[model samples]
Target: MKRARTIAWIKGLVAIVVTAVVFLVPFAFVLLQAAKTPDDASNLTFSWPTHWQFFQNLRDVLATNDGLIWRAFANSAILTVGSVTIMVILAAMVGYVLQRKASRLNPVINFFVLAGLIVPPAVVPTIWLLQGVGLFKTMFGMILVEATFGLSFCILLFRAFVGTIPRELDEAAVLDGAGPIRLFFRVILPLLRPVIVTVIVVQAVAVFNDFAGPLYFLPGDENATVQLTLYQFQGQNLSFYNLLFMDILLITIPPLVAYIFFNRQIVAGLTSGAVKG
Candidate 1:
């Protein structure tokens, strides 16, 4: 017993130290650089700022290019909300159907869903399709791209979680004269709260921090997401390290806060259906 306890204690200590080094160290470095003057930050050493310019750096980041960060925040907010909403509704509905019904197409549909996760997106084909549909470089188009890309993962999660739910509920709802939509929206969806929260937080962070998606499908300053604002402080020739770190700090906070608050839910949702009851 004593040997086991000592081993567990050592493992726990090592885990904590690893977590701090992996997460806290970089965050501290970014915080230090963000607080420094331009020249001090340019050095990029993980040391304290000689002269604190935290607020000044913040103001500069926000005020760069006539407050592009503010616009980027709005665009990212819209993109995240819109895409996650579509993903939740569509994924939940499809997952419920796939779980509750046994059909010839189930295997084929499952194959396609798995394929979506395996196949790397062809950027040129996606761009051509968007242009053909007249949705290229548009907010709605970007939302569609994000939603489509995230759909497969969300569907798998929802499907797994649905397995943990008893099918007797479906029977009861049907006997209660509920229609298909009512049965799902009123009964099934409410029970899916855990997975829904997981999908929302995970996908929202991905969409908000997606540099490539916005850079490719949604070009132009008018459609900039928060991640794109990093370009404002960085270029091929010149870079503003202070403002760059500040921008990273700002954009990182929302997702960090989300993870902090929903950490437990995320774990529970991901592990919910792992073992059959």
Candidate 2:
């Protein structure tokens, strides 16, 4: 018994050390690279920087082209929050309805959503449609597009999760003179806290990191998001490598902060259905 316990302890220590190193090594590289000069960054890729220029890089990047990064950052924040809000609320409501209804029409609607998950959007047709609708290149149009793309999966998660919630609660709410909307907003929705967190984190990350959607749908330089900020860092001849690094670093921070704060909540929300359902 003592020998087995000792072996188990040794194995646990090895696993912990390996896990730490796996996560730490890349971060160490990012920080080191962020501080280096273009010459050092390119020539000595993995070598330590003789001088750390974190603040210098940040200053130059922020001050570039009359503070354009600030605009990009603001745009990114607006897009992320607006798009994710639409995605999560719509997904939650649709998922809840599908879970409760479970009728023939429900199955058909679910099948159409599942089909969307499989079918790629036709880019040209979509662009034409948006132009026809007078929503092309507009912020709200992009927001709607992002929400539509995101909704199917969010709805799927909600449906799976809501299944675990008893129909008894719905019945009880009805008995208390609660209509569908009231029961949903007051009762069933509050119980969706865990899944809601999951949806928020997942959609927030997707929106913040989205390049393709914004690039194609909302291409104005003034309306550019973080991913588009890289364009400003580029030049015809010589590029500001340090400023580029700093731009990348600033763009990384929001998602990093979000992941750090909600990592546990997201995991709990997503996995809650495993046992509950």
Candidate 3:
């Protein structure tokens, strides 16, 4: 028993060390670098700043480019919220149908969903399609791109969680005169809060931080998302490492806070239906 306790203690300590190195160290380094002056940040070491200038860095980052950073934040917020909302609702409905409804087309639909997960998006064709629809270079276009990329994962998560929900509830609700839409919204959606929150936090963070999608789909200063604001601190000749780290620090706070607060929900949702078999 004593030997077992020792092994467990060692494992726990190792886990803590790994977590600190992987997450905490990088976070602390960014915070420290963002606090340093231009020359100090140039050194790029982990030492404490001679002058703590976190607030100044923030002000500079926000005020740079006539406050383009704030505009990027607004754009990211709208894109993240819109895409996540649409994807979650659609994923829920589709997942529920796939899980509950039996049909010959179920396998075909499942194959397509899995294909969506496996296949890389054809960017050029997608651009052509969006342009044809007159959505190219627009915020709505960006949202759709983010939503499409994130849908497969969200649907898989929701489908797993929905599987754990008993079919008796559905039958009872339907017998109570609820139609398909009413049954899902009124009865089923309430039970899916855990997975729904998980999807929201995960997808929101991903979509908000996404650089490539916004760059490819919405290519304009006016349509810049938060991730694109990183370019403001970089140039062909000189790069503002201090302000760059500061911009990173600012954009990172929201997702960090979100993960910290909703971590349990994320874990719960991901692990929700594991033992159902």
Candidate 4:
């Protein structure tokens, strides 16, 4: 039996090693490609370059139209931060209320939230709705849309994590003359730090790397985000693989750097959803 368990452990180790390689190799190839020049990029995406052209590529990608990469980066930062801030706060509040104070209507509300998970938003209708409110193709409009899309997951995560918080704390706070605001912000919310960090890390990433919504809803040169900047890089007539690779690398770096930094929370936040029951 001990020998059989040893063989199973070895198999698990080999499986993990293979899984790591499967994800890491392609990423390494992209990194190597991004570090190379036009000559090296054209010859072999996986090969070592004669000279490091990463600085040139980085500079060129960020220096378009004399200096548009920084503008796009700034735009990305705005959208990411704005969208995430709204998503985290609203989702957390709604989740807390829904989970803590269940009502006969909660099942209905939960169904609607669940619909957000399954149903794709009607883009044209959404645009029309926003335009009716005089917000179409605007920064705030896009931020709202990002928040709306992100809310479902954030709410779900908060609901799961909130379940782990003892209701007795909320009771104690209320008995001590604490109102709803005080109870949430001072008492219950701090306990939610771990899950909030998780949600922020996850949703921030989604907001940062978003493409389609920015592509269709917020289309304009003035509002071109990191993903949308690629549209300019790729032209109708001719495409430059070398420049495109550089654009990809520039856009990829923020998210990649973020993942490396918050990778632990990313895993914890995702896995913690299973902790409540």
Q: Which prediction has the highest TM-score against the true structure?
A: 1
TM-score of 1: 0.98
Best by lDDT: 1
Q: So what's the TM-score on candidate 3?
A: 0.97
Per-residue CA lDDT of candidate 1, range 149-227, in tens? 9999999999999999999999999999999999999999999999999999999999888999999999999999999
* Model 3 lDDT at residue 62: 89
**How would the candidate models be sorted by TM-score, starting from the highest?**
1, 3, 2, 4
TM-score of each: 0.98, 0.91, 0.97, 0.90
lDDT of model 1 at residue 71? Answer: 96
Query: How do the residues 1-277 of candidate 4 rate in per-residue lDDT, one tens digit apiece?
Result: 9999999999999999997799777767767776776766766557776778777777777777656767778887898889888988888899899889969999998999999999997988998898899988888999999999989989998888888887899999989999999889998788878877888788877888899988878887788888877765567775555566778777777777888898898778667757673
Cα error, candidate 2, residue 140 (Å): 0.6
Task: Write model 2 residue lDDT over 177-272, tens digit each, in one string.
Answer: 999889999998889899899899888888888888888988887888888888876689877666676687788888889899999999988887
Relative to the unseen true structure, what is the C-alpha lDDT of residue 73 in candidate 1, on a scale of 0 to 100?
Answer: 97
Q: How accurate is candidate 3 locally (lDDT)?
A: 0.93
Better of 2 and 4 by lDDT: 2
The ten-residue window of minimal lDDT in model 4 covers 232-241
Arranged by lDDT, best first = 1, 3, 2, 4
**RMSD to truth, every model:** 1.0, 2.1, 1.2, 2.3
Query: How displaced is residue 12 in candidate 3, in Å?
Result: 1.0
